[model samples]
Target: MGMIKDAQVSVRDLFRWRQRTVTVDEQGNEHVTFETPSTPPNPIRLLRSISMLGWGAYLIGFFCWTADAFDFHALSIQTVKLSQHFGISRTEISTAVTLTLLLRSVGAAIFGIFSDYFGRKYPLTVNMWILGALQVGSIYAPSWNTFLAIRALFGLGMGGVYGAAAGMALENIPVEARGLMSGIFQQGYSFGYVLAACTNLGVGGATSSWPIMFWVGAAMSFAAGFARLIFPESKQFIEARQNSKGSSTAQFAKNFGKMLKLEWKVCVYSIILMSWFNWFSHTSQDSYTTFMLVGKELNNAAASRASILMKTGAVVGGTFVGYFSQWLGRRRAMIIACFMVCCLIPAWILPETESGLEGGGFMLQFFVQGAWGVVPVYLSEISPPAFRAIFVGLTYQLGNAISAPSTQIINALSDSHTIRNHTGRVVAAYGPVMGIATAIIAVGLALTAAVGPEKKGASFESAAAATTAEAVTDISAAAAPSKAHQSSSVGQATSEEDLAGKKGANGDSHAVLTKTEYA
Candidate 1:
């Protein structure tokens, strides 16, 4: 009943233009409050709050992420062509997809930690260059074995992009705009798919034209790398680095170990949640074009058009739902989106005509990616201060690693079953296989989201400040002569006047510090 009432209020507030505020109590705990604003800030006002530099960072992140998606979807969208080129079964081609996803966790772990410690710019730039070079490698692979190997290597660079990109994109935005921006940011994946589809359409269905798409993907990757070069490090990261100037590599490692020890549960939960999300998107999308061509007997152009429309729905749905999540609350928004997706599974895979398929596909992906829009900010909120990049990237890629076999699994299942298509020809039962799999995944996702934690509107700045303050304190303590001296130093460091000044200046750092001490 309490949950029901909260849901009702959230729904009501969605229409009311409420503003969220955070207040600190005497004990240095933050309390979030929402109240109706006299007039909602217009989009221009919201955009103005982010400033030009913030937008630059956000756009660069978005562009790199989009390029990552394009490189990935290029292969998935052209699976049939690739299978023909390699003279192998479609399932065999999917093995490359599986291998690529399976190794992303390694890349994420390596580059995520690097970005967190050094900076996002260099690691991200290098990752893009690596992706470009690998795409070029894929273009000229001499044989089946060589193609598979290159794709597996491509996964490493691909894995590192999301964490750093997400950290750079969302960390600098105002809290009020994060939901809207997160939705738009996440749609880079869908947009990449749309772009891939358009490229596929333009190049025609000739088997030889597949390499053209790879070339395009390589160019995009290189472009994203160059674009990132024009941007500087994130402002929040710079400030945090300045504040923790005394910390050494050994202390950094020790702090990371302590974070893992204390926040292991959150880490585990994030990985589990991300696994479901990965499965959710890949299961619905990876084989969709193949499903159209094989099950519905559509031609390449028809399939590409349907794919574009479907992902267009994804972009629109993700943006709206992501924006609404600000008022709907993160968990509630995700739960609702997952439920809608489950309801749409039948329509998503059952249409016969091209128009019907396009409509259903669009609506289905709208909700599918809608749930994904909350992920960037939600992950950021849950991550420990000083580890946002690694936490977000590693968890997301680990989830990808776990769900790496999604496309292969779907292909294998479909090949074993036979179903009659619209023209009365027997084909792989992709529709039923994909539909059943998606339904089960959607239900599980909704349940997982319902039970999972939320830290909506969490202050990244406050957390960074708290971590910096703690690092400074540790340094002072290490330099002290004795235990009594350390205690006196600590007391002086956290004197009431100093604490009050910090609270007055930042309003939430003191609360974050209090929580960090106990955590």
Candidate 2:
């Protein structure tokens, strides 16, 4: 014990964790240290290496996505123009959109895994460049085949962008700022939609050729690509890379293994919640608003205004949704969002006459926009870094896939029906169905809320903040400490220390809950 005390005084390891002392005997020597398990940390933070230039570059990626969304309705309506140029049937032209979605999902899966391997910046920049090239090629597609292929190819880039961008965002920001910052970042599309609407509205959608939209897409994609060319790899990605050995392949598999270990029940519930609520929200809200204008038989200007108003409202609503989530909690916020849609859906469907359409469109867009923002913030909080990219890709692209089919099915149903009294009420007809579906899922969520969403303030734990000094003080109170020198335990403290590190500062970085991360 005498020799142990001296050696312990200058031991192999000394950590301060909360306010506790830990002195253990090892190899006939005393090892003394301190550790603090519950010492709340300063918050996770990123170095300011990424300046405003990086943000601008990062933001342009979102702009490309937004432009595509704005062009969707116009493109769908431009079947005649598209058909003439593409030399295919309406069905074939439609496949361009459908396949784009399908392939985008595939791209997300591939690149999401790749981002976990190759680093976020390079993949993101490469994808942006590809998107730009495709957008430009799309501008001059000589036939339907060429156009369809280009669009489908573009989906790969688009898909890659989502996960890579998310990975990049989360990789750089402060831990405490993660929730709110991510909330904002995820809602970029809704805001982008507003920008798209403004472009269309300002330039006059009818006067503008459809090709201009792709030009817009190309420009934004190129801008982002060029800008990100200079950005650094995410620091988090670097840390993850360091922890890894052998091959990126091994790490990826390990990540997948962790994801597989996730509580199956939680996984299922998350998928359901994401798919049902998310799909319907897009279908019921965005699709309806655009279609409602056409249904109202309103002139071009009024139609454009209606679209503009709805998306503008969406932008405003999305921006504030995170604040609401902070108070109500993510799960409850989701529940309330669905409930809000259910109640307002009636209003959306029953605005009665043309004049009332504006009010209906305005009211429904609020929830549609707001509910979406809450989703990203909630999911990221639950995801751990290891598998965040994959889960983000899966949930987001999967949800989009569900909605894409639902959109097709609803369009088929609407055109199939004929009601003399319901002549202009076609768009509204889909609302209650979506609202009902959402409500049912929302109920299941409330029932399993405990398992699905993560604890909001739980990011307080940072891996870096755990130290030996604090650890030793907390343990010393037992006072009757006696242990024969036995074995040695390394004080590397990988997992818990990282948790402390994550507490650095919260920023709106993209955090998507990957099953691996959750595990």
Candidate 3:
């Protein structure tokens, strides 16, 4: 245990962890005798540090995820119209949403493993292609059954996209930029909402043919998929492929089994954390419009305006908070976001009119999703390099599946309570209950993120010996050789000689080394 801090610890054990003390020599060189993770570049400089290739890779993944979000909300926004077309109740149409959420875990498992075992490129390309086809197919559905059937397949295809895209973008980039890029990447969902909303506005709402919207979604997905082909396979994945002992299906299965045996605790904790995260999002969002329409007596126009404002805020907040997490640390930023949401509860729920509610609702989502913006990168960093794609995607979708009924729960709670409006008519109490439930979910999210372990500035490369050597080299590079030589009692380590020798001795070891800087 020369460096116990580098070893992955359980979520339950993270609280027991102690901070390493930094000691400075007489020459003003720093040393950490205990284990500590590396630090990325400053948040402002993070973007400038990445190469153009990194930005291109990130944009490709960003739009792919955005398109995925666009396709999903395409159906959701049309649920009322779809219900009317099928001569079914709104509640019945919700079956499709439930199916999409539940079956996403299936897609994540299949695609996650496939992407991890194969390469990130081809599987993701196929996933996007199938997703586009499904969107088109949904347009021509002859009956309710056909629509639902197409959606089930869509769910599976949709599930695979995030892991593949995230792995492609995140694994290829320089580690220092990952924190800042994570925020931009995750807002693809909010950006998708904005795009879908624009499409809805352009097409003229419910009166416009819903099929037109589906066609738009189909085109976006196809375009995003094909766009990914323009980029090369991720470098991390290429390295992983080279390091892999076997390429056969049997070998893949064995490696997967081994990954599970080694990282089961991480897996379980990830799922639990994701579950609360999903609930926090869905419960706060799905019912807010209903609260406006029912509880505050907002007109259709007002409710729509508030929703648009909320999503816009989500896009802005998600990116901003995500970037800030690089400086603030992931757990601290998330906890701050959660508390900020709690503070916004009053304006969010207490307002009696649309004008009052709109600002609060918009600001509320800003903080909520701002915290969410950290999720993809945070999860990737914590996961074993060999299974990053599978672990992050599977855990996220499983959380979505578990929280699939959050909207229903809110609706049920709302239905159970009755209150008189200004008109003196009894209606479900949506505002007060929603506020209470959201506040509770916010607390859960903060606690979960606080307890979770972070791997800030961890190496994405999976090759053990080379990875360790690389970490040390990176630290030395940051220190500046002449400065480090003058400062440390130990001799200056050169990348070619000292680092390479250490690589052979610790070929199987994997640890992100602590930083050492000379003043």
Worst 10 residues of 2 by lDDT: 508-517
Q: Model 2 off-target regions past 4 Å?
A: 1-94, 202-208, 242-248, 262-267, 352-355, 421-451, 458-519
How many clashes in candidate 2?
64
Q: How high is each candidate's TM-score?
A: 0.86, 0.70, 0.80
Model 1 residue pairs with clashes: none
Give candidate 1 regions above 4 Å deviation: 1-41, 464-519
Candidate 3 regions exceeding 4 Å error are 1-44, 243-245, 294-300, 422-425, 464-519
TM-score, cand. 1: 0.86
lDDT of 2 by residue, 242-358 (tens): 543444455446545544453343355456656665555545554453345444445545655666666666666665665455544555555566567667766666554655666
CA lDDT of each prediction against the hidden true structure: 0.80, 0.51, 0.70
In candidate 3, position 210 carries an lDDT of 77
